[model samples]
Target: MSNSPKKENLVSIIMPAYNCEKFIKDAINSVIKQTYQSWELIVIDDGSRDNSVGIVKELLNNDDRIRLYINEKNQGVSATRNRAISLAAGDWIAFLDSDDMWERTKLEKQVTFAKKNNAEFLFTGSSYINEDGNYYQGIFDVPKKVTYKKLRTHNVISCSSVLIKKRFFGSIKMEKDDMHEDYAVWLRILRTGVCAYGVNEPLLIYRISRTSKSGNKIKTIKMTYKVFRFIGINPFGSAYFMLKHIMGSLKKYRRIKFIN
Candidate 1:
């Protein structure tokens, strides 16, 4: 862990997991490696019927700052996140995925930005890392101010890179629907009249592989369609966005498009 100031603030890092055995440790390590020492790592096992839970328990046993919560059955990501929020006692709420990792100075940099800007909510930029450590990143425009209209088209915030005030959770929680739960939750918080700020620098590593949830083309298209629909945007909007996305994917896959 690098040197972050010994601030008395405690940030709750909530994660919802299903079956992320291969990447869970790297995610946990990313949190532990944070230069900021004032964070509690909360791992919610959404009734994972795999070694995911077992491995999380083992890690919790070794680290006092980590807490592992297991559900009796699979409720879903929305429920798991709500429960984690309910159990958290920190002043700030940060989220991370079981399959993602962060840089050692991520929290340090973001917290400093928040304090100086007096930002109640923050969303940072991120880069994609494959299972074997290959990377690709998006360079997004970090607006001086963010609004619902600005975010509807381009979601500058990644779920795993958001850090918000804990009080926001009490007023706004995750939507249980399968379509864009994270996006919906962000909207809910915004409705309460708080603005979200963007950190231009990329600090988190979002991992993807053949086994990842986002690897499925059909499901990705479905979720994208639903996101536009739920936001009260015209259904035809999805057609334009989906086209752009497919073209982007084509460029991303390049020579191996057929195999990918």
Candidate 2:
């Protein structure tokens, strides 16, 4: 908050692109418009048949900070993110999905927040938007810090809102699972005695597509259960946590409905 020039932290942004031709441009432009200028965006195309790659290519011609990698065959989101992470050069890594957008000062403010709190893993509150970019009701309510136990029940961390120290990535790897891979990685990181902190400000916009995994309530629950099992939580424990997650989600949506 001071007038003093803060240390320049180079943030590497990882984006996994699929058939996101409609929203990818807005996502990339959000990075280009960031107030904090030192960032390299690594966008990996997961063999999208659409014009997603072409749109990114056109943007690449305009900005040297954005780079694209092509996976000839379609890989899952986790694999795509892992590839981008391998290519990342910055000491700090942030994630921005192709369908999400960030506020201009997201990185700038989050960097300072992380340093102030001495947090290695950090995420901010985010709001949902329609595919057309219209604001949807009810933003997330994030805690100041979440421990492993807390996160097992409520995972309010949005991937696009995260800015993490790259050192933490050495121990926690995203599983190649089709669902809840990010949640699994976050849990793994927290289990290693690190607490994830939240900035408490809505700094990112998560676009909701009708076809997205989140839109299918049953699939979301099934995938979460699978993630719990994949992470080695006992069957009963997984069910307990999964139920809690569902209840929490329902409460969140209920609040949104009230707001609307």
Give per-model TM-scores: 0.83, 0.94
**Could you give candidate 1's per-residue lDDT for residues 119-163 as a string of tens digits?**
989987766777876675443335656776556655557789899
Off by over 4 Å in 1: 1-8, 137-144, 231-260
Global Cα lDDT for candidate 2: 0.87
- Candidate 2 weakest lDDT stretch, 10 residues: 1-10
Candidate 1 local distance difference test against the native: 0.77
Candidate 2: misplaced stretches above 4 Å? 1-8, 257-260
